[model samples]
Target chain A: MEMTMCGIVGLFLKKEDLRPRLGDLLTDMLITMTDRGPDSAGIAIYGDEAPGLKMTIQSETPDETFAGLGDALTVAVGAPVPLRVADTHAVLILPEGTEAAARAFMTEKGIRVMGTGHAMEIFKEVGLPKDVAARFGVRGMGGSHGIGHTRMATESAVTTLGAHPFSTGDDQCLVHNGSLSNHNHLRRSLTQKGFPPSTENDTEVAACYISSRLAEGASLGEALEGTLDDLDGFFTFVVGTKTGFGVVRDPIACKPAVMAETDDYVAFGSEYRAFANLPGIEDARVWEPEPATVYFWER
Target chain B: MRTIDMATTPLRDLNSTLQAAAASGEGQWEIVNPKGSHAVAVGLDGPIAVTIKGSTGYYCAGMNKAAKIHVTGSVGPGVAENMMSGHVIIEGDASQYAGATGHGGLLVIKGNASSRCGISMKGIDIVVHGNIGHMSAFMAQSGNLVVLGDAGDALGDSLYEARLFVRGSVKSLGADCVEKEMRPEHVEILRDLLDRSGAEAKPEEFKRYGSARQLYNFHVDNAGAY
Candidate 1:
């Protein structure tokens, strides 16, 4: 028994009908890869919202008690402040120019926040699938694409906030398997450039690093492909964007990832058994995506 | 003989389908795309022969009664554990603990095998063509391990009554276990075993090995190390 890595399941639907009815599709897929994750599970459903930003707070605090972490976000452009506060997280709608101030505030409070565009929303917690969903208010939630995480906890603490799909700014959420051997070096680089990390987990550093690259005009696929040359370790990752989904594998090919594609949807997991029960897949046309390759699906 | 393609079929549905075919008095079964399955030919009570086309997860033919199982790809842990009768042939590699605690059966691997090949065997015949991993026959009470290739360290650590034969180098022999002369009787026995496994190698290409008899009843010298 080697060290267990994270289980990441991604779903991309061609139609809106497949998006809303994704609970069963995702549940069946995740259960097949249960061996990869036995500690916690979560989902981030990207829905149709104004082109804006979404932030997820991963720290020790009562931020989730704030009702409607969903409704508080807005597509404004000026100042940034929390519209509501939840149990251990909060929902804030920041104006465009206030991105600097908002990040500064969260950093000062020792609260880790990653923001993606409004196309993606992330909800995660510790426990099984049903428990995580019930705790995170996933029902009736609509999104075009979603990414999920089930944790086995090889290194990081098993905290609710630590469950993935983590964000970098808004609409950009990431889930990862395998450890980053060069995290300290990467973290030093980011913190020197005013991006002080909140958590000791290496995944946070990876999120920020990719976010930084994309902000510098590097496409999602390019940034992920760039990671293979720069990062040193075994890892397989999937990131959800508003327009599409991105996937990558480390150079070593130590971790496993299986992907299944059809006109209706494209799904991937750490094991072949995970995608065996997709609803519309009448034939088993699954393939193990080669290591060091990045896949981009925009629909 | 009957052939079934299990490419996209659910495992439960395939199991029931095979059972139905057997109930109808089928003598031979061939399965393809058997990706990572456990207990494939379990509890069969007839003169049946089955060949699995691909790799399996665990316990491929556990507690087999009277059926022969042949696997085309590698097998995970416990290939024929606790098998009662019949044969299991592997065309490719095998993982750890193959033929573990088996009472009676014949298991043959055409390729390499991992650790603990014949652990706690009451009675069985396990033949390997390629190299074996560490702890090949641990705590084996009674069985026969014929290895055409090299064996890893600790071939037999604790032995009650088990016979082992190796053609290549022994990395490290376990406590109270040493090499012995291969008599003409043993050579003839190995020749017959090789022919049964469909191996084309000559009988003289293999050598015989077993316990050094110092461990038959443990003494102070053998007791401290093991």
Candidate 2:
């Protein structure tokens, strides 16, 4: 069987001063893995939380879709809504308790919500890593932690929705490397449990699976550990929450994964090259992640 | 010494340069800043010595012949896969299928090796100083696999003719694989392989494993085993 290789990278800064370099370092890491996936790329950045909730939305026709969207949303919710447009995506900041109202409005307007959270802002597109990073100006943004993925679309179509860093929970996202064997079955089960997956991508199912586990009062570590038993197939997943970064591989560990940690930060990559050029990497403790073991760091 | 810097040069150019050097019978090459590139120093036929300074991605030093390759860092899946002849040494851990279906070579891993270390091997000699993952030597036709540390589940499934030696515990044996007596001849072979691969484990500390010879031909008595 031919495996569709993808690339996953994550960085959690342990030092406050290094926060400004997160996007720059992550961009280099994602671009180094361009050969691993050529179809699409996505990144989720965890930055400062505004006074309200931020929802990222994407559109095929941004000019028509985003025109006067802020005023229209403000009118619908009877609250001031601020919208920031980036190439094909827009970030809408709404009051704390207005997520459901905003989501309903988006559904009626046919605008696709990519992710919604207090701290996370996601940007993804169907293009090379370099172009996608440029499209969103990822290199200029600053964050404390972030996760990125380059997709080589095997299970789903090559579209913005199919890109990774799939967010199924507030302030949470997941990027996966290998395919799931029982995703179709698990997808139906998850849908019945009220965590309905929206994409045909198996990785979306995995994201929702983790989100549902967390919703059941499982810690991030416990949720990742559950994957070893419930998720059947080879996978190396890098999951990020508002305050933690976690990594886990399948029991067989058919995919490639390596991690490096320094006093300044902890990093995960499909291969070592992704973090090889990061600051203070020369003295970092680099090792391959043990199979079926969950490694996570929380701030 | 010829040096190829992956930081400044493209992968294709580096591979073509190595191919040209091999054609001229030149030896002693060094790859600086490999940066996890895949398929480095592959398909070399001449007796050359290549040292990769950093880690590499999948299929590094693959399909090699008459060359000695050394990687200072770890390697990804299928390292030395389908190799015909030569010595490939990894200073760090190796990913899955370390020496899959290699016809001939001496591949040594100083650190642990992931699943399928010597799958379908056809005459290659592999030595791992550390543990190996599951399904190792599966469907192995002919070769020698030496594991100084423990082996994971289903070791040597559907094995054929290949000799296996493990110094540590095996979680479980495969359908057609079982423990075999370590005769003086087997001891001699294990010692030779250990010496060639530079493994420090003594031959006397090892135990031999091989096919049970029941699955060679279809028989109703062995149908359940299959």
Against the true structure, whose TM-score is highest? Answer: 2
lDDT of 1 by residue, B84-134 (tens): 878989887666678888888799988777667787877888999888877
Query: How do the residues A61-80 of candidate 2 rate in per-residue lDDT, one tens digit apiece?
Result: 99999999999999888899
Any runs in candidate 1 off by more than 4 Å, and if so which?
A: A1-3, A56-116, A137-139, B1-226
Best by lDDT: 2
Q: Evaluate fnat for each of the predicted models and list the values in order.
A: 0.00, 0.45
lDDT of 2 at A150: 90
**For residue B130, what is the lDDT in candidate 2?**
95
Question: How would you encode candidate 2's per-residue C-alpha lDDT over B118-147 as one tens digit per residue?
Answer: 999999999999999889999998989999
Give the clashing pairs for model 2.
none
In model 2, state the lDDT of residue A195: 99
Shift of residue A78 alpha carbon in model 1, Å = 9.7
* Root mean square deviation (Cα) for candidate 2: 2.9
